[model samples]
Target: MCGIVGAIAQRNIVPVLVEGLKRLEYRGYDSAGIAVLDTEIKRVRRVGRVAEMEAAANEINLTGRLGIGHTRWATHGGVTEPNAHPHVSGDLIAVVHNGIIENHDEKRQALQAKGYQFESQTDTEVIAHLIHSYYVQDRNLFSAVQKAVTELVGAYAIAVIAKDQPDVLACARMGCPLLIGLGDGEHFVASDVSAILSATRRVIFLEEGDVAELRRDQILILDKDRQKAERKIHVSDVSLASLELGPYSHFMQKEIHEQPKALSDTIEPLLEAGFVPELFGANAKELLSKVDGVLILACGTSYYAGSVARYWLESIASVPCQVEIASEYRYRDAVANPNWLVVTLSQSGETLDTMEALKYAKSLGHDKTLSICNVRESAIPRSSEMVFYTRAGAEIGVASTKAFTTQLLALFALTATLAKIKGRLSDTQEQSYLDALRHLPGSVQHALNLEPQIKIWADRFAPKEHALFLGRGVHYPIALEGALKLKEISYIHAEAYPAGELKHGPLALVDDNMPVVVIAPNDVLLEKVKSNMQEVRARGGELFVFADLDSHFSESEGVHVIRTPRHAGVLSPVVHAVPVQILAYHAALQRGTDVDKPRNLAKSVTVE
Candidate 1:
């Protein structure tokens, strides 16, 4: 998951490219680089944050009408200046890539035999060499790029600039995302709309195997065979204010605190739209009404949200639901039934595995494909038969906070809709669930109030290298989400165990050095989770808990409890998730890690 931005302006565009790179910095930050073609050669590449790269580029001459910039999340190479993107060939063909070449080894071997020496240990270098090789034979940049891409396998969204064709930039996408922005006397291309949001609202989302030849005043779309193709231009609705952290310390913390608004945004639209029939349209409602089961595919935090939703779907809707990790779902020999509804969850909406899984399910004739996503007009939503959008705004943190909660909110709303559609819940029950859904915004606000206390608690546990998260029943998935977030951003060795499963194997890891975080929300399993906490305490493991308000636990004991408001069985997962997010945020802060741009993590996993 890397961010790529390119611009061909009527005037010097280095500042615009740098600004756009900064906006897209949340996607990746291991290294940043820019290549601009002007009267002479100007290139700046560095192995650090965007700010570092910008500082280095400031001292150089950045005058250019066309440029491309990249913030890399390393794949197939180490994080170094030589490996950073905007790789150039000997003839000054600069390129920025966002995906891995699966057949790079074969391509590199052939190129090496032809006396093409590689400088970097990246699959992306193959693209530069291949393009250079084709240009040497064809002498046409666009035709050379098309020919080179025909030989490549795996996902890629690549933008290339040649010194001979400084007025033009050619871009192509396979499995990865690439967008072309239509601006006044200029053109822009980026991996996502966030990079070009400030410069242009009109964007042309390139489909797989589509290439665009962008110039300062025009853009042309072409197919794999270089045939002309029509393109649709979509106007983005993103606001500049959504990218700011506002009053929060980091994007992660700001997103954590924004859960209340995010939930409200997701719920209000559905409530105002009535029920399932109105939200999913006639086709989706007809299909969902006869669905026998649901299979959800997602990755990381979104997968954890699906785990929690599985319980809700089974319990409230009386539908058998299975949650599968998208990265592994396609590789397995799983059965797909005609009555099965395959749902995919994604925050950026461009997650590669989730998109591939959706396509695979559709290929199996499971037409009832639904997507739960936050970003509108994303790849997943475009490919699904129906889509439920979560209005979580812009979640810039590499470790997701708001996106997870909003996904849960959307899934819970869908569960309620499905329950009503199936006639499983009575009027009073539906009313009760609806009322609870309305009250969630306030409950999330109450959870946000615990941030200061969590920060204080974080100071005590941040020094520890290992931790454990435990929960029972529905809270078990919440514990898993918590542990995933902690491990993702803080680089902590954390594990999540169902409280009941601790005795099986995880209990052996408990010691005084291990800080165990227990999700003990008051429910039927509260006592069970408490007993598990006591077992950890007996083994000399320090405890941090998000307990129910009415749970009977001594406050002055060794246990650290962050009390959550008492809620119904299904609602506790949404409430209990907030504190764990806060814990991860504060812990990362205390450890002095880059909370927003964590190491080895990207906001969107665009490449499989």
Candidate 2:
């Protein structure tokens, strides 16, 4: 996923573009560039962060009334200055793109046959040439862009600026995210809302195959059929300053500590009023009542949240549940039940694989689609029959922290509602769950209080090359999430097992050199997991256990124990996720790795 920001305003827009890119840097950071249209197309690009691009633009004193910028994550080519965005054609047209063009090679060959030379090895550069080829025939930037886009065959959110049309910007979106920000005597376009949050809160979310013409005073949109269309502008409730790392060392740590507030916001509506199915949508109760089974499609951390929900849905709601990795879900010839509720979980709501999976499910006669996402007006939410929004705000860190817990909160609420609807839970049971929801924010805060001691454990883990995370019952997904965080940020090789499976084959890898972390909450399976820990200790494996307050585990020669807060039954997974996040953050900090922008990872997976 890359970030794109464009502006058409009365004054010089170089500073505005750079500031927007800075706010949207979490989307990508491999390289950044900007192209401004004044007397001619002036451009500067760097094979580094946006800060480097800003410095280069300053050194050259680049200025213009309208401009477009991009921060790239490198899709088709390597991260080099020439491969950066703001690619130009014959010094007149400049283009910035965010997605892959599958037919770029074929288009490039056609352009080359016309005696057009290519300067960089990128799919984006072909777009500039293709637009230029169209502009030569019509001399109209908007018409040229629309004609050129009709020939392309993949996902893209692109912005093009012409030297002749200095006051105009043309942009389009197909299978990727692009939107317009409404302003007074100025207009903006960006891949994300956070980039333009400082300038304006009012925005128009462009639909698929929509083209926009942005000028200083007005924005005109055209539908896929080349006809004028109207779109509603919605105001965002998110504040601009929340995007900043206020008083925190890194975004990861800030997000980890923000879990309490995130949880509070997510569960506040559910706790305030009694369980109402309309919280999801108008006819949510009717749709949920007709459902007999649940199918979850998600990727990465969101999949782990679904895994935990699988346990709750099956046990508490008496509903059969299945979880599938979104990337692999659409490729298989799996059977789809029409009565099944297909639920997709994503933080950005624009994850390509998950979106594709949702489409596939709907094609197979599963029209009852629901989305659990943090964003309100994203692709998945717009395509769903109902949506449950997680109020986690912006999670800038590539590795998810607060978003995961908030997803769990929403899923837990869904589970309780389903249980009550099915008469599987009594009023007393519902009240108990509600009381636990009221106490969850404080429970997460208590978990954060353990960070000082987790730092000591992280100190020991920083030098280790590999780690094993073990859990049993519903906590197995927690172990998986923990291993993923460790590997994602710390760059440490890690794996997770069900603890009972350790002796199956993983026991051979555990020894004095490898550290084994156990999720030993005081539940029914605690004794079974303890036996598994004994098996590890017998093989000379060092152990770190996160036990509940009442668990009878003490520190020994090689076993380190950190007592967690009291358990909250079905909500234990949410509480357990905090220590895992803190451990990963502190471990990466001690290891001197980039915590916010990990190598070869982007915050959102918008492309395949």
Give each model's whole-structure lDDT.
Answer: 0.87, 0.93
Residue ranges of candidate 2 with Cα displaced over 4 Å: none
Overlapping backbone residue pairs in candidate 1 total: 0
Which predicted model would earn the best TM-score?
2
lDDT tens per residue, model 2, 108-145? 99999998899899999999999999898867899899
Clashing pairs in 2: none
The C-alpha local distance difference test score for the whole of candidate 1 amounts to 0.87
Model 1 Cα lDDT, one tens digit per residue, 1-608: 89999999888888888998898888888899999988544789999889899888888756689999999988888999999989988856889999889999999999999999999999999999999998878567787888889999999999999888877899999989899999998999999898988889999899889988898888888976678988787898888898887897898888888889888988897667655655654577787887888899999999999999999999999999999999998888778887988999999889999999888888878898889998888889989888888899988888888898889988887788888888998889877778888888898888888778888888887898999999887889999998998887787889999999998999999998999999887778877887888888889888988887777766656688877777545788988889888888888888989888887788889877
Which ten contiguous residues of candidate 1 have the minimum total lDDT? 273-282
Which pairs clash (backbone N, Cα, C closer than 3 Å) in model 1?
Answer: none
Question: What is the lDDT for 228 in model 2?
Answer: 95
C-alpha root-mean-square deviation, each candidate: 1.5, 0.9
